[model samples]
Target: MSSIPELLAVTNLNELSINDFIALLLTVADKTDLHPALKEGLPEYFSGGEKLREMAGNLRQLRDAAATGNREAKAEKMAAWEAGKLAVAMNAQHLTMLSLHRKDPSLLNNIGLELKQRQQGGKSSVNVLAETPVVTAKHVQGPSGPVSGSIVVVISRAKNTIPFEMQMTDDPSNESSWSSQGIHQKSRIEYQELEPAKRLYFRVRYHIDGKTSQWSPTANIIVL
Candidate 1:
């Protein structure tokens, strides 16, 4: 067994949630200040920060669209956010790994990474076939608010969990009509400002480790 610590391989940074990815960026950036060792890779080390911020900006557009119930704009913004996030994270991972490469792996502590002691001959990683978690329509609650288009999907949660991506569409038959409702850490999510009297559809999905689950079974509710 190798007594030396090694960086925990986060080979799929794209699988991280946006907020988690941001946290990782903050960690590495902060660590640079404490580690004079990073001086050589300093400039390049921070290069991905700008892209991270831009991806965050794209995320804000998604948030705004979801809040106002502009489903079409929400879809567009979600697409932009996803693409930007993937690109930024992939680039940052490459740069961060390069900066830390060949350095003391103990430096990984508190840098949004875990350190694992290396084995002389590591066991081959096993491929676990990840099954998609199932989600039911659960319950669709009619609007209690005075608003004409407010509706709530009362999803019961067992406890605290990562955000489940919510998506909606006015027409289930139309593939292009689906739009993001943004992510909700809570199980119960409410969507408002929907077009009145329209039959809308909803679904949920989440990512863990390196796998993304298939979209949940579709749920439908008519906007009041």
Candidate 2:
């Protein structure tokens, strides 16, 4: 355990050094359960740190608040903690966008569609799909040959019937490596064909009223 003086030494948010920022993110990544897409992409943003001692110490305040038996204070602290976790996720997304934009500006296009939609005069659609959709894949026969089969998307909390897109990739580590299969009305798409012994990875995104959600966590299948 680090001493109080050591923990207090962490740079404040406004004064965060590059190392400190990385440390903070690394710490959060280790401690919290995050959206699967964020979980897979965030680690590449920073490297060479196992923990953020100062941030860890700060989290102890949450524990203390919970122990105090003050309902209001505990609720407030927990809410702040939840907000902080979200901030981390959003921050990671921003950094990734910047990097992708630098490599290929078009890659960042539609990356923050939901946020952009909110800024563009408010939500145009009554439906809001904030949660990342989960996708699955299966192998089946096609008219021409064997296909990677179709992708099935499940959006658990969607309020409206909306169009969804499928992104296919062979390299999971490279976000830019994906090829979009475009949008469709139904929840399933059967357009992808695969060679024998090849693997296909799939992710789905919802698009409604000119806005889209981030791609979901990947699902994969092998063509027999």
Candidate 1 structure lDDT: 0.51
Q: Which portions of model 2 show Cα errors greater than 4 Å?
A: 1-127, 141-160
RMSD, one per candidate, in order: 9.3, 16.3
TM match of model 2 to true structure? 0.39
Compose the digit string of candidate 1's lDDT tens values, residues 160-192.
464355667777775445655544566666666
- How do the predictions measure up, each by TM-score? 0.48, 0.39
List, in order, the clash count of every candidate structure.
0, 0
Superposed by TM-score, candidate 2 places the C-alpha of residue 25 at a distance from the truth, in angstroms, of: 34
Shift in Å, residue 187, candidate 2: 1.6
Worst 10 residues of 2 by lDDT: 3-12
Candidate 1 lands at a TM-score of: 0.48
